[model samples]
Target: MARTVRFHEIGGPEVMRLEDLETGEPGPGEVRIRVEAIGVNRAEALFRSGEYIEPVKRLPARLGAEAAGVVEAVGPGVSGFAKGQPVSSVPAFSQNDYGVYAERAIVPAAALLRRPDGVDAVSGAAVWMPYLTAYGALVEVGGMRAGDVVALNAASSGVGLAAIHTANRVGATPIAVTRTRAKRERLLEEGAAEVIVSDEEDVPVRLLALTGGRGAEYAFDAVAGPGVTDLARAVAPGGTLLLYGALSGRPTPYPGFDLGMPALNVRTYTVLETTRDPGRLRRAEAFVVSGLRAGVFRAVVDRLFPLEDVVGAHRHMESGARFGKIVVTVTG
Candidate 1:
């Protein structure tokens, strides 16, 4: 039997229970992996609390989508993978269909990526989701180019830091926005050209002044609420505002009409748009792999928790005090 994390009811981190479960064989197009590390994300917290975009389809549901481990077995019709090979699982599958928070777990083959040499379990587990989301939205879909300026919020989170690196890699400038000064220096050290303290200063005004009144070419917003209106004011003419997350837990309103309807374009995006597509995923993988090999990218982990302390890990993530990814390590 494998120790797996599951929730019987929708609630806080206290509701999650690590119970012994049968480690079953993989079905068709699936692979069973011996998980070594799991990446904790806000999505898991939202899922457990019944506030995610995708609802809990049934009771006693599993709770993770990102992990790094060694392959133990492959189901029928699966190729390009073998037993004992190192691999990392990305957030490419639905949590309702599968989860990786277990000593042994079965995940779809499509979600597996061969972990590169020199990448340990914690680094592998922490890299994919955040990098893919930033690279896919900014580089692949947004067509971000050199000399462009991108304003992104949630600067201390994993994805936010990745966005800073991605922008710098492409010769663009990344302006990071956070709620307080506690994380300003760290954000600057992470390659952000400028850090905007949203609570201390006016975001749109700072963005406008920094861009010499042209505004940023793109505003990548994670917290979507009434703040979209303020961010809209900082978008250059014909620029796009990409809303990729809803961390605000409130309603969001389109700001075009409210701001006199300037020549602005607004759109929503998610990493799934790239991960779910074969062509896009391939391109993104190549780009990120090149960056990693060249030392242009790195995984930033804030804290590590043992498998038995998954509840404490979730509590830390919800505390809003972390600066990077929270990883959970599994042991025999």
Candidate 2:
């Protein structure tokens, strides 16, 4: 029997339940993995509450997007992967359904990536969503280049931290924005060229000061709403402002005149758009894996909870108290 977390209704964290499920053999081009660690993402929370654009289709839905595990069985048509091999999978909504949060999951072979020698299960599980999102935004969409100045908000979150690391790796200067003064030092230690506390300091003023009044070449904003105006003010002329997430639960407000005056490119970006091309997905996976192998990218795991404690994990994530990725450990 496989143990899994499932939810029957759309509600708060309390709605989740742990249940016993049966596992079956993989079909052609599929592989069965004994899950070790699962990443807890904000998307899962939104999905549970039925707030995301894509609605949950049925009751008793399994909630998870990514996980790391060891292969237990490989289907007949699958090659190059053997049973007992360590692997990580990107189980997006369109690919696999209702299985990643379980003790074992059957996923398509194309979704699996070999876990590099130096990477552990916990880190491997944490790396997929945030790194891929960051890579797609910064390198692919924003066109961040050497010597460019990049500003990132929510700089302590998993995606924000990944952006900082990616910026540094590409020789771009990263300016991190956070709401807490306590996270400043740590943000800088994590490769941010400078840290801006949005509550204490005037973000646009500090950004202008840092860039010698020229402003940043690109701004990656996770917090939407009026905060986007501040990001717009800090963008250099002709720079791109890539709006990725709405952490503030409000729509990004753009001043009508500002868009025309500076000729700035303001666009909403999502990982799905950038990674839609097969080549881009391959390049993104290769880039992130290479960074992990070379030690340039480090997965910051704040805490781990048992699979049954998922409600607590979701609450912790909602509180925004964690500095890095929160994970759920599944044991057989």
Best by lDDT: 1
Error of 2 at 128 (Å): 2.2
Shift of residue 28 alpha carbon in model 2, Å: 3.9
lDDT string, candidate 2, 128-155, tens digits:
7788888888898778989999999989
Candidate 1, residues 1-332, lDDT tens digits: the string is: 99999999999999999999998999999999999999999889999999998999999999999999999999999999999999999888888999999999999999899999888999999998899999999999899999999999998999999999999999999999999999999999999999999999999999999999999999999999999999999999999899989989789999999999899999898878988898998898888888899998988999999999999999999898999899999998
Global fold similarity of model 2 (TM-score): 0.94
Instruction: Tell me how far candidate 1 lies from the true structure as C-alpha RMSD in angstroms.
Output: 0.7
Error of 2 at 80 (Å): 3.1
Could you give the C-alpha RMSD of every candidate to the true structure, in order shown? 0.7, 1.8
What's the residue-level lDDT of 63 in candidate 2?
81
- For all candidates, the clash counts are 0, 0
